[model samples]
Target: MTTLQILWFILIAVLWTAYLALEGFGLGAGMLMPFLTKSDRERGAVVKAIGPHWDGNEVWLLTAGGATFAAFPEWYATMFSGMYLALFLLLVALIVRICAIEWRKKINSDQWRARWDWAQSISAWVVPILLGVAFANLVQGMQIAVVKPSDPMTAVPVDQIDLAHDVHNLVGGFWSLITPFTLLGGIVVAALFLSHGALFLNLKLAGDLGDRAAKLAAPLSLASTGLTAVWALWAQFAYGSGQPLAWVPLAIAAVLLIVSTAATVTGKIRPAFWASFAGIAGAVAFIFTNMAPDVMRSAIDPAYSLTLWDASSSYGTLKLMTIVAVILVPIVLAYTVWSYYVFRAKISVDDVHPAGLLKDKIRLGENFLATN
Candidate 1:
């Protein structure tokens, strides 16, 4: 309702968009590990391509979640508590993903690396699918109800209660979340990330490996475009807010994805990668835009929905957070940009040794430090 509340909601959406755009390809590379790489050296090239950027990419997720907790405590509490199982699985998968990536090359054993490769591949799919499902649920509306602090299921703390005092609670548990539309959403994002990752591999690897990645990217991007088209239409017609504006971002997403697929087929890998990134970003924007005044919609009853005004923290808190964000966000952006620029060289299979480190450490070129 208030300008600051709306601004924070938009900021949170932007953070989530950044997370998917940056992390999607990294995880997608992991998803491709088992299928794309015939040899450990090739897999090592894949790993090196994503290694310097993955951890930094994850920071966006952390920031998004933290912002939600701080700026929209009620929304955060209800969503996290209601969707605990799915998020728990997501967390487990993330932990497994990190371990798989960090430890896979440490032992320098083929058997060891293979096991980790499968784990990473599985985790990679789970993360994006669950995330997509969760975000889709947000847009499609959940079984939410309004409850007072006396209610056991409601997650609001008494101390945080204020102007909008009613606590919003999710009615059903995990089973309620599984739906045909939501499943399609899961598939859509998984395909999107896979396409994004393949394009990334096309950019990052050299020789036959890069060409193979490019070859795979075309089909994956094509599939992503088709899947996204189906899912976007389904969402817009069924669960969308029915506003004319909602269709704009969805339309942009579809067009960008088509451009991405075309670029891949035409051998324009850089444009293909960027178009895929922009397409995903546009899709996320549509999701947020569709929500409008409500942060969490109620399928049980319209009156029970949680709006941005109902969920937002105090004005003073928002003011302070805005100040902090202004000071820190640019620093983070600068570091991310600088890091990527410094490590911007393509990694060849020859660069990776049996241990997955650089085959030769004596190189002092700017790209040489990417191994670090």
Candidate 2:
């Protein structure tokens, strides 16, 4: 592989890591809203804790998709087409989750808020689970059939022919995406995000809410640690035997999860959260590292696997993309950091009162405008 191909692969991996780390807490917070608080004001506080950053965090998802499409069009085409149903459901869940967040506070009716709360909760849970399943499948390899086109006039050599035009078909129905290993992956990620969110709530809330969050975070983090350790070992045994280097990140992830659990038990919320973030980043890195060189592995035949070198766009396209990314990525990171700094204050039920709804709406509007 060329240096640029390897660089783009690492960049894509970084984007996915950033998405899971930042958005994990937001989705976890949303999933916890209904169960974490007894009163509407308390629930509002839970929602508000992540409200300022949820939309911004979602940009990572968009950027990751865009990056894949630009850098590895074949990988993008096969993965998206193969996993169309799953991706469609994920899109719907994301939309419902976002809409619920924005519209839940527009009125004061209990029934209305309750409906939206369910919407938000269900979608939040579904999104992460699906993402986890997708990632797990990527690691496990998919049933991909690559059919090359025949062109007599061009007389292109078989070895030199690009498979971009090959018919990359996924075998089986949507049900095939669900399996024992993939389900385990989904559970692990869901548990990790739950723990991450609980720690965030602990950090951003005060009084009874914070105490509850801390208590909840302890168990969730423990669960996450256990599940992650299991998943890592499973992945290592299942796919990492050939790539011994993958074990490094897997071991690091296991250690980070342990640290996260310990810190949570000790009531060190910030340290616990960062550890959880690092654990997730390490876990994702392990998967990509294991799958490296091959962007998409074929379950049926190793010969049909899509490699970074084979699947990537033209050199000129990648060079242009690299220039654009270098210029824009840092600016986005800086603004995101600045926004977090500005909003780095604890919240309480009092902060989400009916009287403050108007201010919240105005602030939300400004955030929307600024992000757009």
Candidate 3:
């Protein structure tokens, strides 16, 4: 592969890593909202902990998708088009989760808040599970068959061209995406995020809430460590035979997972949170390492796999993208860091308020009608 192609591949991987690390905690916090606190005020505090940064974190997802579409159109086409249904559901879940976060406090009614809270919780759980399943399938390889454009001289229709046995269009149902290994991957990520969220709560809450979160984090971290170990080992044995170096990241991830659990048990919340973040990052690193050169592997025939070289855009395109990314990525990162720094304070029941966008809108409407 050209240097530009390699760079773009790494950049895409980094974007995904950032998304999973940042958004994982947000999702975790959302999932824990109803269970972590009985009082509405406490639950609002949980939402407040992540509210400032959750939207910013989701930008990574958009950037990753845009990067893939620009740098590797074929990979984007095959993956997105092939998994359209699953991705649609994921998008829906994200939308619901975002709405829940924004609208939960719009009214003072218990029933209104409770309805949105359920929406937030369900979507939070669903998004991570979907993402995990998708990642596992990517690692395990999908049934992808690239179709070539028809020759114009022969006047052959693109759809009617005879395809080789090993070459066909993307074909599979939702059931094809799920497997024992993928299910395990979903569990591993879900557990990891749960621990990460609990650790975050420990850091951003005080008093009884903080204590409960820390206690919850300990067991969740332990469970995550075990599940991650199983998933990593299985991936190594199943797919890393040719890529022996992939085991290094797997080992590092395992170590970090262990460290996270230990730190949580020792009541070192920050260390535990960072360890969990590093552990997830390491797991993603291992996956990309194992899949290197090949962007998408075909389970039926290895020869039909999509490699970075085959999937990447032209060198000039990548070079231009590189320039744009270099200019914009740092600015985005700086703003994100500044935002976090400014909002780096623990939230509590006292921080909860009934005022929201809906209230402002209602007042504006009343004023307009009165003036009229």
Candidate 4:
């Protein structure tokens, strides 16, 4: 209700949106590495493109998580408790990805690095899926128990609480994590990332590899975008809120996806990249619009839905955080841009001289390609 609160909400939303858009590009770039880079030289370039910035880019997820915990403790508690398993999986993926990036060069044995390569690829695919699932569960609400923490003697146990039927709190399970809407979200994320990766390949790798990446990105993005369109429409019908804009972003994303794919297919790297960028921007916008006003909506009962009004932290905290963000966000963006600019050339095999973190990865990729 306060002006400060509204401003804080806007700041957090912007931060989250930017994070998804920026990181989404890297995720796409990483996934395309294997496909776009056919040789050791090209793969190195792909890795090098993302090397300096991946870690920094990932800070957005942390910022969003910490902000949510501080600003909306209640929503954080409810959603985390409900989606514990799914969140856990995402954490695992994050760890694998970080470790793979760091340890790829420590070992000389190609096989050893190959394991990390596999880990990198799997985690890359899973991160978007887990994120999509988590968001879907939040919007749809999950099966959760209403618990009061007043009368416990020592510690509250799961066994002691009444296991009641509350549809808004769904148990974060394998099936729930792979629901239709969530799967579509996952596909959208993956395809968009792959498209971004293709653009990155064009920017980072020079010759045949970049061309291969371009070829791969166009078809994959188109297929995934088509799937997303069908699922988005189905979601509107299945979880019909009768809100016209609920599914509008999906349509917009589809159009952007088509443009991006077409551009890639036609060997228009710059246009494809911009189109992919627009597609990603549209996807995030769609998500925000679909879940607007309410950070988390209920599939069962409208009364149980949690909104920005109900889930916010104290006004003082919001105001302070907003002030801090005003200074912090710009600095983050500046450094990010600087780093990318410094490393903006395509990587080549001749550049790999048996040193740095990518030595083992390059060798492994060579071996893997040779074997296949």
Candidate 5:
């Protein structure tokens, strides 16, 4: 890979890892809804914990996609085309999940509230699943018809790569999305979010709600750490390397998991949150370490597999976008941190307005606007 390409890849990896960590907290938070909150009032607390920042967290995912498209067009095309169906469903789920939060207050009716609850629940649940699936696919590597130099954009002349006929391809595909590895990732993520929700709730809510959330946090966190360790090892092996290089991420993952669990068990909420974040962050680090160079590796022919250099956009395009990103990324990070600080607090039953003050701000004159 060219220096520019490597730099772009590194930057994209960092952005994606941050996105996973940042948005992942909210995902973990949301997934805790069914288990953590009992009533509309407590549920409101749950919503309030993430309500202030969830939208912004979502932008990272968009940014990551944009970066991918800019830095690695070939990889983008191959992934989107091969996984179009999965991506479509994920998009729909995300839409519904975001909409549910806004529509919840349109009416005060119990049924309306209940509908919102379902939306919240689904959003929380489906997002992590989609992420896990996507990661699984990343590890599995899809079948993409290699484009020859001249035929790169020749329309329908290229054949699509198929996973069904190849044992290695099929194994990789199943391994990517369906294995114990990714599912463990799913579970660990769920628990991490739940713990994050608890911390968010403890900071934002009070009375029975906060106490109950706190009670659930430690156990959820511990379980998640355990699952993460197991899956990290499996993922390392699955990615290849019979030698000890595979153990690097596994050891890092284990340490993070252990530290996260210990911190949570001791009731150090923020530390626990950070530690859990560390665990997930370590996993992302491992992903890069294991899958570097190739955005997508081929099970069929190693020669045909796409590498960072092969899959990337032109150097000019990458340099242009990289310059732009260097300016924008810090600003994005600053605002994200500022917003989180501004909104950080324990949400209460009383915090739930039929129309919350922050609600209008989120909508900006849209249908979900709060009266304020």
Candidate 6:
């Protein structure tokens, strides 16, 4: 692979890490609805805690996709076409979450808000699980075969695959996506998100709600750390290309989780929140680290694995993308940091219009906006 291809590959990994780190807690907030809050007002508090940044966090996902399409068209096409159902579900979950967040307040009825709240929670949970499965599939490799467009049925042996004409296709159906390892990954990811969300609540909530999330923070972080440790160790030995370098990020992620758990136990809310963020990013680091040299490994045959060289777009394309990304990415980062700084304050049940604030409720509907 050219230097540009390798650089773009690493850049894409960073984008994915940023998305998971930023969006994880928002998704976790949804997962915490049933456990952290008993009433709609409390639920509203949890939602509002993440309200300003959730949509912006989604931009990383789009940026990642665009980068892939531009820098590695073959990888993008193979992945999207192969994992259509799962990727479709990811989009559906995001859409449902957006709808639930925006429409929940329109009608101002208890039932309307309750239904949307449930939708948000369910979608939130599904998103992490699906993300886990997809990433795990990449780590473990899929049943992909290289074939010519004309003879899609017959497989081109990996040795004979013509990078110019033959295409890599995932022949296995949706059921093939499920396996013990992938299932473990799904649950572990959900656990991490739940823990991360609880940390966010601990950091951004006040009053009894904060206390409730605070109590959940330690146990959830501990449990998630344990689960991830198990999964990472297993993957390190089995699918990690037997490389010692993979262990570095896995260890860092595990240690961060431990630190997060301890920090939360000691009531260090901000540290715990940031620790959770970095921990998730570290875990993502391991996924890409272990899966490198081969972007998508072929379980059917080692030779069929798609490497950076095989999957990348032309050198010119990658160079152009790198230049554009260098220019635009910093702007996105600056905006994200600025928005977070502006919204960096705790939210409480009182900040929500109190539902009983009927005077303003009648005009604005029961929405997340505080009257100030």
Best by TM-score: 6
Candidate 2 clash pair list: none
Preferred candidate (TM-score higher): 1 or 5: 1
Identify the runs in model 5 with alpha carbons over 4 angstroms from their true place: 143-184, 241-250, 356-372
* Model 6 agreement with the true structure over 1-372: per-residue lDDT tens digits: 678877888899999999999999899999989888989899888888888999999999999999888888888888998899999999999999999888777766777788999999999999999999999999999988888898765779766878788888887777889999999999999999998998888779989998899899888988999999888888888888877888899889888989988898898978988988999999999999899888888888878788888888887777778888889999999999999999998897999863322333465555667765
- lDDT score, candidate 4: 0.66
RMSD of each: 6.5, 5.6, 4.3, 7.1, 6.2, 4.4
TM-score of 1: 0.91
> Model 2 scores what on Cα lDDT?
0.85
Clashes of each: 0, 0, 0, 9, 11, 0
For model 1, how does the per-residue alpha-carbon lDDT over 98-132 read when each residue is reduced to its tens digit?
Answer: 99889898665788887888898999999999998
Write out the backbone clash pairs for model 4. 28-193, 29-197, 142-168, 142-169, 142-170, 143-169, 143-170, 144-169, 204-346
Residue 148 in model 1: lDDT: 71
The estimated TM-scores of all candidates read 0.91, 0.91, 0.91, 0.83, 0.83, 0.94
Better of 5 and 6 by lDDT: 6
**How do the candidates rank by TM-score, highest first?**
6, 1, 2, 3, 5, 4
- Runs of candidate 4 with Cα error greater than 4 angstroms are 2-6, 38-42, 144-146, 150-177, 244-252, 356-372
- Runs of candidate 1 with Cα error greater than 4 angstroms are 153-165, 356-372
Which residue segments of model 2 deviate by more than 4 Å? 148-165, 355-372
Per-residue alpha-carbon lDDT of candidate 5 for residues 106-140, written as tens digits (9 for 90 to 100): 66665677778778787778877767767755664
